[model samples]
Target: MPSPDRSSDAVTPFHLNVPEEELDDLRDRLSRTRWPERETVSGWKQGVPLDRARALVAYWEDGYDWRRCEAALNGIGQFTTTIDGLNLHFLHRRSPEPDALPIVITHGWPGSVVEFMKVIGPLTDPVAHGGKAEDAFHVVCPSLPGYGFSQRPKEGWPVPRIASAWIALMKRLGYARFVAQGGDWGSAVTTAIGASGDPAVAGIHLNMLVVRPTAEDLADATDQEKASLESLQRYMQDGNGYSQQQATRPQTLGYGLVDSPVGQAMWIYEKFREWSDCGGEPENALSRDEMLDDIMLYWLTGTGASSGRLYWESFRAFGSDKVMVPTGYSMFPKEIFRASRRWAERQYPNIIHWNELERGGHFAAFEQPELFVEEVRTAFRTLRTS
Candidate 1:
């Protein structure tokens, strides 16, 4: 429990115990949701299918359990520390392996720390999950300010600011040096941290590499680069409506999402379907309970507006700087945007590891925990020794 005083550096252990009344209210809201008529087009073209939405809501109201998620979070060891006047929440699990490397994994939009739950065990205790002792990590997964349990900012919390906070966080935890990994907004922050020339930041890795292709590069593009461009174009044309709305006018969009559990569920649910390797069925990649566990973080905290507001704050800041650290990247096929190795190497001049994975998607850890864990272990192994 962090003290009420603002800007305090006092780190406090935190436990999650959502009131029973809030659970009751969530069920009540789910029961009363007035769903719109089903989409005219087939198969998620219009949005989350009406039938799927109703089924998810029905399960959420009846079958889903928040207590399980809460207990899991507490079991993982939750904590809070006031950084820059915001009470930031994070999960810190120290490895039993003596020489474990400290690593912070950041999650992006439509996600919370819940994204890393499956991978945390494998990452923090590799021996327990069938990996080498050398692959073990002291894992820290933070709720990005204004996203999950972290305190919402009244104004100004762009990506760089978040990166600085993370640097400070690692230092506060007695990690004199560490590596970083992330996807989506997490990639941008990790890049910024690597770019900061902070000796404490040993290296970085990203599942989503953000790099702008030059016109010259496009003119002489390889087949893979051409495919990458096409995928990005499709996203810009069709899949980017949420970004435009959240980046420019999150407040207007937040009202409905904040007030309605169904709205928040669908908003995130659609992304899980479209972004994962699930092939239009999100449940194929993640269980209903897993999805609801994440959704509950937002619904329970009433952070629908605050979370979307991150795009408004830092949407345009991606790929703004080059990273000089020994960077690594694992490209999951279903990620929204991907850059070719050559293009990415130019931006990340000291790239140490680069692999284009055959399976997985935007939510790498959540959808394919084994693959994600392998990628991280492979990426940061040298850094751990160096």
Candidate 2:
């Protein structure tokens, strides 16, 4: 284990060991769930379907094995380090290849470090995963402050602060030069880090590119740009309710999420159905185990409120600045917001790679790990020369 940085606080090795009693309690709660009348409309229009919610809860109570998830996390080398008065939890898996590049992979709202579990092996130990040793990366996946195992911030810790903390984390780990990759809010933080003019941040890769266009930019938009704008507008109209609730009143929402396991599950599960490339059901995109494993991260840690608080801090604050570093973007077809190459280039002047992927959605890594790994590898391959 790496020793603590005495100047700040110790970088203590951490493990996942939720108590048996908590698991029992969760099961009991699921068993005693108070039912609500089914939605009048068909499908997921109103929310997670009543039948789907009940079925998922039943499996969560009887079939889910949190211990397996815990062991998998522990197996990947978990640790906590105090950064800016918060104990930040992260998975630090150094590549076996000495020359591998250091890269920090960040997750956004409704996601934890578990998002990168499948890609970790391929990135950190490429040879073991049927890749060349030269393609390896020292992968670091941190739970954003106030999410997962990380301690909640007493005050606001927005995207810029989170970016700074990430840089500090990389430096503390003896990485003088590193790259960053993220999607969703992770994209915001990575963009901030790239734009901060930190020489340590060699480059960044983003799956979600949030761009703001001026009136003139919108007036002369291409077909793709116009379509992208329309999609965003639709989302702002119909899909933004949860965002608005979380940003304005996360505390009120948290009560239900924290108190009812079914509530928390449905809150996230709805996003999986809506945001994923799964035609109608999220099961088409991720396995039942995969979805439940992610939910357990929130439920076990009781971070329902704290996790939603990130939106409160930075939801309305996207694309405030331009990123000048060598940047790469992978635009998944089903992402909530898609930026055309021209629009993206306006914001990211030094974009080296931009690809519109055919599959995947917001949770790119979790939904399509193989494609996600390829995208990451391809995005940073040239930057590795630095």
Candidate 3:
């Protein structure tokens, strides 16, 4: 791929530095990765199909340049701070305008602040690019706890705890009443942050919101609702195994993931490729570098295990009280599944807007930045003024 553009527009403005010894160690590990034999199966029907992962690993070792990726990231502005004992990392780009709205963005598992790289420019300097100043925001994108540059917590850090830390981070940055947006795991954190009702939070926007079936919907659901429910059921059957494990026995899995980079890559790559809008092959929707960049962030940071712990923390606290802040939901077409407006309304009483999009998936900001920015901008536009 062409050298990454080093414009101020880049959202992730930080480069990772693996110690000389660490790089050598990683290389040694890659060289020593054990190959696993597999029974013949039809396409990814039996999970990642072993051969594909081997090919990716071969390319990763022989072709991929970590230094180049590190430079690409460092080209943007970045910083780190201690929050609630965990060191938090973030990308902060101030808007050119004198009065830009402060908006904080969070990323989910398998994603770092890197997901917002495409939209940082537009969100921070809209007026300079023919967009209205009102659409501009001083974007604050944080690598969720135990992910990216952030240090992993020894104790469990659940969604509510994360949300609390984010609220505190914004306060430290002097954003008393900022807007918040997230996707996937981010959606959960942002929702909890909104629910905190910390006057500093103006509104919440999300690309992924899992609304549990309500008593009424379950009683008299339409065919579409039934289909949606089935989709959810199927997801739980096939997809939720990861969540169950993380919630219950994250430490057990973390031991293996933290040791092997290939193992860590496979664990996350499978989710990105499977849970995305990609047509079977992830390369169809995302470039190899793009996929690897995310994986590299987790691997280099050694955050695979710590990040997985969020699943356990959040799932344990899922059935608490509802979040009562002004909320907005962006309905992406191929996000594994989406909750209907009615379903979302049941959980978030203050939902002010529900947007249906023509594109995007679970990784909305990365997959469809324009759509992601528009939905977020529109959702919070009214709240910002009021």
Candidate 4:
């Protein structure tokens, strides 16, 4: 396919045709990975264990098929359009129900639109999935500007900027009034969209709610708030090295990630395990094939550095004013930072729905798609009536 023309608002049809050489090179690299010594202690204290790494790498070379994922994306109706001088690739699947609400879903680092595959069909066509017509959504999942199939940025593209692009994107797609939803970095952008008070947006929803609790709120914290605080502290201390590196020197770290298929797999695989409530057993959360498919997006696109640059561009500056629009939040127990309703209310004053789920984690849609869909449909149900 010709490279996407970047000068116009044309939404061009797109297809994936991974050359045979790319897969051949990936297999060769996976086969030749220089083995690392086993951890000094045990059970993921140092990082991904040597044995686990070997198992995944072995399967990545022999068991995973990238063609299946390519076909799935194409079947979902992928397209590319220029927004803010960048070409964005997105999956757009309209519901059979014409009145279905249009919703844009965003993905975060180490994740691509591939993460939402399990929930898209169920969401876009609720009747086929045993849901009422009123619950249907015209789903749009974008590969974040510097991630997945979207084009890389030449300069800073922060959260507010991305949120603006998404607003324009939805309007360009004929959605005059729609809701927004996201998690991870997507949560930041979605929140910014609501904060923009974009007249076209009806409201917003987030599985991961990021909020800063003030001293006054902390003084009157509940048990749930205390637990949330503990989780946040742990992440600040132990789980944020990757964020720091990405925010500071992504290009320096990209060489190994882009060069070694095994390196890229483990970097993301570790997060999938640690964040998805499957602490010691990653395959318990996602099959090696599923994990490898997400890895291939990073590997084939060679976007390891470009994707991380979003962190460098917006990490410290990723916050929003109080969102006055009707908001909905689902707090997953295993998420890196589980904000209490009161804490979230500081940023989102008009919360219409709040549910503290007993299961799932950061990759909510990928790990627990059924629950994720339920939360989304229920959260937006009230907004639809208005």
Candidate 5:
């Protein structure tokens, strides 16, 4: 195994040091944004209303503090490395206990390294940081290949390729055996890591588990399963317009989104509302600034196009292989991942723990930090014993 890339020696520090001029430019552009008149549809029927988006934009332009969030992020140990010829950005914080297990946490699309921001201090320095030493971990949260600070891949890269790169990253960090955790696209990547059978990857914890629909399960499904299937069908129907567009014609859509912050926010906002169980208003569960923080990452980095390319890559690899690793699944009430335990077992016979949570939505880490952290901790505990 390669030695940890200690070329930097001490842990690296991070800062959200944007030029003052750039912030001024963003503010100017927001002020100059040309808006369209609203349609007659009520609620979210017509997507984000013009008035609502205007309110959000107003807050983003006047009230939000990017530096504050950046300072909070910089408080943690951040690092960057060239892996597979791409510049990779990650937050690497080690527990006080030298022997603590190393775990890599990956963030999904529309999510920067922001989701883990709330959990890092607690996970890495659990004792002085406020938790048990046993729950301590050396946490590494990487911005995906084509997202955030990480340099985008010239061409499309699939989950397996990304998983391989993560394995290489862990190896580079001097971790002979470590665990992986993620949700959404992060979940997909985590599954691929285990499925790759990398000996160094001790276990995998995923909030979004994907399994093939069995004939029997679909043929005579339970009322609950049927309800789930209907929900899935509806998502594929009403909610998957963006997915279809991304998978087929992301470049065509990218032209408009790249040029307009409002368009970009609408694209992400639609998913945040549709996929999450946010009780009528997405803003109720997620602060407007929090929403804009995520949206701005794509806008500033101009990653809206590359981030959408995951759908195209995923479509190519979907249903072609099965991941036979010791995997744990955390089922949130709002996600459309309604696979039965039997179905999941068939695909992943080494399934260790399958948790069904009563609260939280797709953004489990951000929405329910304590519960999500506990699930990951519990899953690793079981995996360690096995």
Candidate 6:
């Protein structure tokens, strides 16, 4: 059991026990899915393939086990706490090593605390995972507001506000000082945390960086920089429809997503195929169980609308502020927007570590857990002060 809530701003233990009725409702919904006709052309250019969607839903209804996912979450010690009037859910695992550094890992859209499940044990208990005691860390993985189990905000909650909430959350957990790490929107929140100039934030490490290059920075771009820019352009042209919808009119898109299980699954499954290191099929990068486990976070929470609202609230707000703390960046090859060190350094002046990895993509931790863990351990090894 988790420690009791100590004060008004107390942290409370949380458990997952979805009622059997909810599971039955999900099966019923999946059984009665109203899928559209097959795409005019073959392949994923049109979205999740019809046959693929049916196959996944078939497994989800019959073979997938929500209780197993619940057990895995409970095994890690889940907890919740009120911050600025919103209840936030998090996984808190303290290291056996007394002097381990404290770190907070945040997840982004189409993802939840599920992304960190594989990496948590290794981070908090390094010896058992083939690492020195010095490599251990006390890891905290928080569900973003409106994502997973966290309470959705009634009004707008931009990245800056989310960053403030994160800092407060760490302080509430008795971590006076800690490092922040993330990918996707997690990267945006971590950047804001570092930019807030909070002394409690020792440093930040990112697998995905949100950087907007200036005319000056772009004029003398190197070959790699040019390639990065081209990738961004391509994404803006072909891959930005979902972002545009989420940013401009999430409520309009939310009806279908919230009402249909297949709607929610394909919405996220498409990203898993597009953003992951998977060549064509998402299953190549993540197992069916892993993918559905994440999808369930959204489906169970009924947060399809709220989560999409994050983009509506802060899509254009990224790269508006510069992060000044000691920073580390791990650039995965297939990330939607890859920023070269030159582009990123212009925004993060004190960048201490920068590496271009051979594989992985937007969902770095979910796709390549071991590589992600190694990158995190190596990135923060130099930032630890105690």
Worst 10 residues of 2 by lDDT: 1-10
Q: How many clashes show up per model?
A: 0, 0, 6, 0, 0, 0
lDDT of candidate 3 over 115-151, digit per residue (tens):
8887898899887666898888988888887888877
Q: Candidate 3 overall Cα lDDT vs. reference?
A: 0.79
Candidate 6 residue lDDT tens string, 50-160: 889989999999999999999999999999998887888999999999988899999998789999999999999999999889888999999999998888899889989
- What tens digits encode model 5's per-residue C-alpha lDDT throughout 73-151? 6778667777666667788877787867899998886677888887877787778765788777888998898787677
Compared to the true structure, candidate 5 yields what TM-score? 0.93
RMSD of 4: 1.1
**Candidate 2 C-alpha lDDT tens digits along 122-215:** 9999899988888899999999988888887889998899999999999989999999999988998888889889999999999999888778
RMSD of 5: 3.4
Q: lDDT (0-100) at residue 127 of candidate 1?
A: 94
Q: Candidate 3: give the clashing pairs.
A: 13-76, 13-77, 14-74, 176-200, 177-200, 247-312
* Whole-model alpha-carbon lDDT for candidate 6: 0.90
TM per candidate comes to 0.98, 0.97, 0.92, 0.98, 0.93, 0.97
Residue range with the least summed lDDT across 10 consecutive positions in model 6:
1-10
lDDT value, residue 15 of candidate 5: 52
Overall lDDT per candidate, in order of appearance: 0.90, 0.90, 0.79, 0.89, 0.78, 0.90
Two-way lDDT contest, 1 vs 2, winner? 1
Give the Å shift of residue 285 in candidate 4. Answer: 1.4
Misplaced by over 4 Å in model 6 are 1-7
TM-score of 2: 0.97
Encode model 4's per-residue lDDT on 1-386: one tens digit a residue. Answer: 44897777888989889889989998998888899788999788788999988988888889888999999989999999999898989999999998899999999887889989999999999989999999999999988988988888899889998999999999999999999999999999998999997899999999888888899989999888888898889889988999999999999989988887788888898899889867668778888878888999999988888999989988986655679999988988789888877777778989999998888889889989999999999999988868
Off by over 4 Å in 1: 1-7
Report the lDDT of model 4 for residue 301.
89
